[model samples]
Target: MVGVGYTLMCEQTGPKELVEQAVRAEQAGFDYLVISDHYYPWLDAQGHSPYAWSVLGAVAHATSRIKLMTYITCPIRRYHPAVVAQKAATIGVLSDGRFTLSLGAGENLNEHVVGAWPHVHQRHEMLEEALQIIRPLLDGDNLSYSGNHFEVPEAYLWDRPETPVPIAVAASGPHSVALVTEYADALVCDNPDAAVVRMYDEAGGTGKPRYGQAAICYGPDEDACRKTVHDQWRWAALNWTVKAELPGPESFVSASDHIRPEDIAQLVPCGPDLEAHVSAFQKYVDAGFTDVAFVQVGVEGQPMFLDWAQDELLPRLREL
Candidate 1:
């Protein structure tokens, strides 16, 4: 089945607004919610980066029925796998089994804040080790691990949900796709890349769910929408290779200095055209994604987009 979800971008809004948006998203007929976890917003202009786990806990208490997930959280560096597993379990229990934990190899922007930044290959290795620690802990098992990247001594989750929390691994390449196939319940991608899904299937992930996220700015004023995205999300158009190595938001700002509004408009669906939004989501479905989350770039456009989604885009997607 194809599922449509809403994205809660913590980088742009505070915890209170995020909780309110979650409630509105569910009421607007969204099937699930995907929240981004970050220590810093990509651009200083985006402003806020509330602790995603704390905000998610509040969202759990505030909303019922809608599934919640971290769009992607890095388990290494700033957070230990054991701690992440425990937090995920508690959130799962709080949300009544409507929670999923999405993992990524991580970028320097968030991980560097802790003063420990590994090489790209090393980061992937750390993620694999993290999964080794997280999976069993979420199963309510007490265990110790001695990996090159991390060590845990008889750590166990005391408040795990009756059912183990589901894990969705975010993958943009073949290596990560293979990694997720072995450890995750689902595969998540930011782009509508069919080859990533195909690689996951070839690596023994044929029946697992594939989740995708796409960003869009929906507003009546085209220039205003483009300007907002250009200012807040121009970093999105940067290559992952560059994004992975950037140390902080200031570096991102310097890197995104050349990105123009027209460039962003070309990449992201901007303005109030229903077809533009519909087509953007359709690309994910056509790419074999079972679930897709639309991230609204303009914070003020959220309610309007949700209304349009509930009344227009969702029904069109359902017909697909």
Candidate 2:
């Protein structure tokens, strides 16, 4: 089934408001709630970056049917593996096993607070180590293993789900996809290019579920949607310029607005029409993405975006 989702940015909205929004998304016909995790917002925006796990806890009680997830959280840097394991377990239990852990090596915006970004090779190595630590903890198995990057003492989690909440690694490039295919049960990516999405399927993944995501404004009018794009999603779009290469350990230096569009344009669909949105997402479907999560960010006119998404966009997906 094709499932619709929303991004919970820790911003102007509070826990109560977010729950309302989550419920609203459900009421609007979306099937999942994706709460984004960010330690800090873009410097200029000064928006609230709420602790996503806490919000998900509230959302758990608030929404009974919709699946919940982290749009993509960096397991290696922003939080420790133990913390990730515990939180994932808590959310899984809270949502009655409707939680999926979407992860990545991390980006400069979030990981820099911990230290210099690990080199690309090291980042993958770090993620692999993180998975090693997280899996057992989530399974309620005692763990005590030491790795080149991280170490965990004799620790175990008692409060875990009855079944493993499928873990999805958010990957873009071929290398990361291959790495995650070895460990992760699923793959989640914001990039919508058919070829890009196919890379994941072509890699080690055969029958695993895949999630494709994109930024959308969703309003009835074009101008309103554009405003949302500039306000929210642009934080990632502005400085996506990859003059050097895909970010890695040494390469992921601190950067903002400097991010170039060429890098992310293929990932974030532009335009105000519903057809464009469908076309962009269809690429992912054509590439074998069975699950698609659309973040209703970018472009204001809140009611317009949500209403159409439910009444129009969603119904069309039914046909697809």
TM accuracy, model 1? 0.98
Cα RMSD for candidates in order: 1.0, 4.0
The number of the candidate with the highest lDDT is 1
Clashing pairs in 1: none
For model 1, the superposed segments whose C-alpha errors exceed 4 Å read: none
Report how far residue 88 has shifted in candidate 1, in Å.
Answer: 0.4
Task: Tell me model 2's lDDT, rounded to 2 decimals.
Answer: 0.71
Q: List, residue by residue over 1-320, the lDDT tens digit for candidate 2.
A: 66667766565455666777888788888878777786665433435667777888999989888898887778887788878988899889988999999887776666777777667688788888898888778878889989998889788887878998778887777877876787788888766656645776677676787887766555555554454455445455533434112333223323434445444444455555778888766776777777877766632345566777788888888788
The TM-score measured for candidate 2 stands at 0.85
TM-scores for every predicted model: 0.98, 0.85
Residue-by-residue lDDT tens digits, candidate 1, 72-155: 899999899999998999999999999999999888889888877998888989999999999999988888999998989789
